[model samples]
Target: MSVHFKKKAANAQTAIPTASLPDIIFMLLIFFMVTTVLRETTVQVRTILPQAEAIEKIEQKRLVTYVYIGPKKLQNNQVGETAIQIDDALVDEVTNVRTIMYNKLTEQPRLIVSLRVDESSEMGKVIDVQQELREAGTLRINYSSKRDIEGTL
Candidate 1:
């Protein structure tokens, strides 16, 4: 019996299986969708920003912290007394601002506290908050204001 020797083909083409490509893509999309964070703070107080002739916009928003000061909006379209808001919570006591700001300062050393005070709000409260901020050693403050449309016109 004579046995025939067969030579294996050197140029064998191998293809990457893409059958699970769609499944892998779907899983990755779901993973990103689930992990992504949408950061929009629910503002408790209503702020009517005062118009300013000259206003400088903040470029690095991540380094800024907002403190909203305005009249508390009550039920039935009624407005209550002036209130201080930080993030989503209302400041129970003015003194607490110092500690809160100090903690925030530690977290971000270059923290810029942006005061979003309403037009009708009193300066005394603003000054009080400023004092508390000063006590906290957070001196970099930006008064958030809307640009004067009349000036542009």
Candidate 2:
């Protein structure tokens, strides 16, 4: 008896199509470009920030209120030294600051108010501001400062 032997079929090759990969990447890039929100930097008066040894990292959700101190020039054309300006205006009293802060706190109770005072600013003024914030019911206050080498608070 003669038996016919069939040749083993060649190994089947499976090809994966990668032509859609570029298209998928392009679509994702376009989606991110269209949906991404660009954050604008906050504006404030320039001041030399104080340095600290230990500092805490601020969360993104915290609300920041900037208070600037600079000089107030006289209307008679006399230039004065730098002074504090709260919201672009001179801080006449803690009440004014408290009023504004109170309004802001009312809108956002979990506000983490950050104080970025200049190194030369009077401690009394800074403490007053903090006191005002405390009176206004803003308990979460952060003092922003540059980190020193020793990492002391």
Candidate 3:
């Protein structure tokens, strides 16, 4: 009689399991879709844009900052005195625009200030805002205006 010994080699897996890959990708996609926010601010000022002879569209909205200059909206659908609004807050002083715009410029280096002035608003307010923007070192500006329908017709 002879004694026999046998050795068994252990089997191991080298490839990564991709069985739950689709499930994980779908979960991540749903998470981002739910968490993302589009527009946050409610426009406090009313801006009935001025009509222009020629209008150019802005494709990159992220690079643009809107400055609203128009009559403040009061209760009972009444319009108050001419007011300046930056984002959601109403600007109190014209000189403060310099600091506000300077802060915005720091956040976005290539900031394009879009003046959405009301058709009825005075030029002096617009000029003041422009001067402040110049002091803030944000020279690239775009005046937002609607296309003239009467002229086209």
Candidate 4:
């Protein structure tokens, strides 16, 4: 009795084709390039934001509307009173805050009002703004602050 072992012939090309790899990569690149969006928030007011040890990152900027609550930027090195800036206009009266904020809420239902209040700002002003926001049914508010300093001692 004779035992015979036969070997199978190998093909010239690979079993899996990689010819479409560049095409697939190109499509993916175009997909991400088109889907990527950059949102910009322009602040026209002078704000000296308070410092905080703990801070939360905002994931979606489209849902946020910045309300700068700080001292007014005056010329000739003069110190100005605390005021609120909505978009590009400097609104002196707290009463006007609601209408603007309400309008924003109408545009974006899930709007987050971020208060960039100064460290030296009066708590009363901040509270008043909060009250107005509450009246406008904008309960989603965020306080913007810088990272707190660490002590050597």
lDDT of every model, 2 decimals: 0.92, 0.70, 0.90, 0.83
TM-score of each: 0.74, 0.60, 0.73, 0.69
Ranking of candidates on lDDT, top first: 1, 3, 4, 2
In model 1, which range of ten residues has the least summed lDDT?
A: 1-10
lDDT of 3 by residue, 1-153 (tens): 233455446678788999999999999999999777588677777789989887789877888998999999988998999999898899999999999999999999999999999988989999999999999999999999988888955
Best by lDDT: 1
**lDDT of candidate 3?**
0.90
Residue-level lDDT tens digits of model 4 in 39-147 = 4545555688877866888888779888888777778766588878887788878989989889989999999999988788889998999999998989998998777
Clashes of each: 0, 13, 0, 0
lDDT string for model 2 (38-86, tens) is 6544323445688886688875544666666434456565545555565
lDDT of 2 at 61: 44
- lDDT at residue 85 of model 3 (Cα atoms): 89
Between candidates 1 and 3, the lDDT winner: 1
TM-score of candidate 3 relative to the true fold? 0.73
lDDT, candidate 1, at 62: 82
Q: Candidate 1 overall Cα lDDT vs. reference? A: 0.92
In model 1, the Cα lDDT at residue 77 comes to 78
